[model samples]
Structures are given as C-alpha cells and as structure tokens.
Target: MRFSGESGNVTSGIPFGLASALSQAGSVLVAAPVMLDGADLISATFVRSLAGSLSLLLTVVLSTERKAQIRSMPMPIARQVFSSAVIGTGLGMTLQLYAPSGGPVGVVSALTATTPLVILPLIWFFGKAHPPGLAWVGAICAVAGVALIVNAG
Candidate 1:
C-alpha cells in the first residue's frame, strides 16, 4: 500500500476501501433481517435513499468547492450523474434487497460480487481503453471466489 501524503483522507487511502467494505458488509448484514422477516422492502429502500442523499447533501453543503463544482458541471455530465444515480441506486438497491429474500447471505453476496466482471465487458463494449491485465485477474479471482463460496455452502 502507498503512504498518504497529507492530501488523502477517508476517500483516498486503504482506509477508504476498508471502510467501504465494512459499510457494504453492514448493509448486507442488515438486509438479512429485512428479508428474513418479510419486512417492507420499499420502506427500507426509502430509508437508505434518504440517508444517502442527506449525507451527500451535507457533504456538498459543507464544502464550497464541491458546491461550486456541482453548480458549474456541464449539462451532459450532470445528466449522466443524475440518471445514473436514479437508475443505479433505484434498481441496484431494490434487487439487492431482494437477493437475500431467498438464500444464504454469503452465497448471495459472492454471486453479486461479480461487479468487476460486469464492468470489464462494459468497458470493452464502450470501446474505452482496455481494462488492465490486473483488472482481468481481479475479475477472474472474484468469479473464482464466488464459485468457491457457493460450492462450499
């Protein structure tokens, strides 16, 4: 791991990745209960959306730089961000909430963890620069890990 040079914080270093993973794991942990008990999935999703929006809103409100960037964002990029936030968060969270409704969390998580594999082909489809060789390795490893977990369970 590289050392931070005073310009990095929660979103930059290994701490960020660790914290992100922990937060994801926590979400999965909490979702287990919601699914198992037949809780209102919509209500849970609402809470999630509200919390995420509020936190991001707070960050932008507190940071003049971020507010300026948002204000000055080009129309195309802003549209992309807005649409992505809507479609991605809406569908992604809804399905994620549904994933644990039928099976073990570990297996579900492992299967859903194929995000890297999904992204690689999308990069290829977009004719973007090919993802690095390490990315392919990581994608393969993610698939293999899922296989191992599913088989073990």
Candidate 2:
C-alpha cells in the first residue's frame, strides 16, 4: 500500500512490476515444457492447486492479522478468489492448451500482455473506475507493442 515516506508518495513501483513480470516469466518457462509434452491441462491444474495451497498455508503461518483481515472482508476476498479461479487458473489452463499447439512461448507471452486492454473495458463496464483517455491510449499502445513484437518474431 503505502510505499514511501510519511507523505506516502514518491515511491517507484518498478521493483514490484519487475518481480511480477519475472514471476510470470518463470511460470511460463516452467509450464512450457509440460505443455509441449502434451500434459498441459494436468500440469496447469496441478500447478495452480499447489500454488494456491502454498499461498494459503504461508498466509496462515506468517500473518494471522492478514487472515483476520481477509475474514473481515468476506465479499472482497470472495471476489478476489473467484476472479483468480476463473481468470488466473481457468484462463491459464486454456492458454496452455492452445499455446503450445499454436505457437512458441514468445508469441503466447506477448499476447498475454494484452490483459490490460481486456481489463480496461471490464473496469469501465463492471467496476466503478473510469480510466482516463491517456490510460486507454497507453493500453492500446502496449497491446500494439506486444503485437509488433510477436509479429516480428
């Protein structure tokens, strides 16, 4: 949340962004072989279940307060869990099913970067966040850049 000093500003999110990117890259790298070997669905489900279990265990072990917080906000927690189950696990498995058969990891990963574009419309329609014009423009540019990279490869 608050990343910086008492002012709660002037903090760079680059490290967090890099960590997320690296994590996703590692997941894709690990899953690619399984997918190419034609065990994608099983591997994806196993990985998701394992990760979710470990995450829950870690949270319970490390932070009782966090667990209490989650329990206190049941609706938000439920929404997050549902979204993760659907968008993260379901979509990931679906992607793995098609990715290896259709193209290389680079193309699939590049295409995956288009999530922001998908989220933009969803946020506008379902959520209360009305992103600015520049946000939409940036999302478009990001998708275009990924498209160019995939096509170039």
Candidate 3:
C-alpha cells in the first residue's frame, strides 16, 4: 500500500480503525446501562442532551475562530446548526434509545456498528444516488461479520 505522509503506513490504518471501533463500542456499552437504568427513556435523553449541549457550548465558547464565523453568519449558520441538531441530535438519540429496547445489548451494538451497510440505501433513498459494486461487497461483508461477532458472544 502506498504510504501517504499523513498516514505513515497501511498498518497505521488497522490500529486506527480498531481503536475507533473499540472506543465507539465502549462508549455505547457504557451509556446503554445508564439509559436503561433510568426511570424512563425521556429521563435518559434529558441527561444526555444536557451534557451534549453543555459540551458543545463549551467548545464553541472556547474557539475564537468559530466565534467570529458564528457572529458573521447568524441566520444561515443558525439554520444549518438547527438542521444538524434535529437530525443528528434529536433523531439519532431517539433511535439509539429504541435499539436497546428491541434487542440484547450485544446484538444492538453489533447492528449499530454495521452502519456502513445501511448507508448504501440511505444514500439512494435520500440522495437519489446508487453506490458502486465494491460498496455492495463491503456492505455484505460487514453484515456477515456483525452477525458472526454478535452471535459468537
């Protein structure tokens, strides 16, 4: 594999991918029980939303460059931010909470990690564009791998 300066070697990709996957899995596993143990899904969502909002606010407040851009494009920028909040924050969190209610944690997590598979159809449905052949093969492999991994436990 050609080693770009940014990615010293092909081997670097392996560790980076594994680390990211592990970290995401760890974060989900840690959060699932906390959400599940709460009095209701709304309570869990409230805590997560409050924490996420505070963290986002802190990041925005601490960034001078971002602050300038935010101040310059108030209306258009605010609309984009609102859109992101609706889809990524609101809809995404709602889906996450429902996943655990439908199945075992391991299975839910495995399915969640197979997000790449779902992207193919979502791209077609939402973007009206189809993925290439390699994407199909990769999605199939991902689904099979997730099935094996989750069922192995």
Candidate 4:
C-alpha cells in the first residue's frame, strides 16, 4: 500500500523525526515495567493513552489560537486529521504496546531503528521518487546494524 506524507506533501524526514521523539518518550514509560518488574503493562498503557487524550482534549478546549487555526483550515483538514489518527494513534500505539522489552536495550533500540528503512521505501514507491545511491547504502547498513545488534543479544 502507498503511504501519504503529512499534509499530503512530499515525505520529509521531519515527520519521522517527530515520531521518533514521541516514540522514545512513550518507550521510556513502557520500559519502566520491564526494568522494574512491578507495573502491569495494561496499567502503563492506560496511563499513557489517558495522559495523551487528556492533553489533547485540554489543548483543544483551552487553546483558542490553535482552535482558530484549525477552524480556518480547509475542509480537507478533517481527512488529514483522521488519516493521521488512524495510522499514528491507532496502529502505531498497538505496535508499541506489543514490542517486547525483555531483551538487550541495544537490540530493542536497533530493531526500533528499522522504521525508516520500511518507511523510506514505501514513500519512494508511492511518490515515484528515487533517492540517491548513498541513501540505499545507508538503508542496507541500517538493516545490517540491526541484525548484528539482535544477534549479539
């Protein structure tokens, strides 16, 4: 399946970078139980989701500037928001919930780093754009690095 970039524009690494930051923050919370062995995964996930929902709701309810900006956007904005929610908040969260943390940090970190490989190819295929040879080489290196880390674990 083809993937649409943010705001239906070209795929820049910006969205991926933002996703990495957000995922890192969420993983910090998720990894607590793995390291401590007391907290339940369900509880941790509930806390994460609840906190996110509340923050979003609060922003929508309180930020007049943001609300106005959103309101001023075109009708297609709903579609954009819906698409992001479905892919990001829905499927993305499910995957994070299922990713195991019982292994070496390096292994988990390496595996998590493979996202760009899959996404870049999907983006290129969907957009019919070809990246430079170095990009392809880097992608291969990323895969190989992940393999080494996992094997070492």
lDDT per residue (tens digit) for residues 15-111 in model 3: 7577658865775687787767763666666666676687568867997976986789879669977897878767776677667766787888787
Which stretch of 10 consecutive residues in model 4 shows the poorest summed lDDT?
1-10
**Relative to the true structure, how large is the alpha-carbon lDDT of every model?**
0.75, 0.70, 0.72, 0.65
- What are the per-residue Cα lDDT tens digits for candidate 2 across 1-153? 221223433335566567657766777777778777877486576775577567557847787876876678778779987797787767765665467567888777777767757878877787656877877888889988997887784
Q: Which stretches of candidate 4 lie above 4 Å from their native place?
A: 1-81, 101-105
Task: Please provide TM-scores, in order, for all candidate models, with all chains considered together.
Answer: 0.78, 0.71, 0.56, 0.53
- Check candidate 1 and list the clashing pairs: none
Better of 1 and 4 by TM-score: 1
For model 4, how does the per-residue alpha-carbon lDDT over 1-153 read when each residue is reduced to its tens digit?
223323544456567567656766567555645545655656666666666767667857886877987789787778877787667666664455556556544455566667768867765786587766777898999899878767763
Clashing pairs in 2: none
Question: What residue pairs are clashing in model 4?
Answer: none
Give, for candidate 1, the lowest lDDT window spanning 10 residues.
1-10
| RMSD of each predicted structure | 4.4, 4.4, 6.0, 6.3
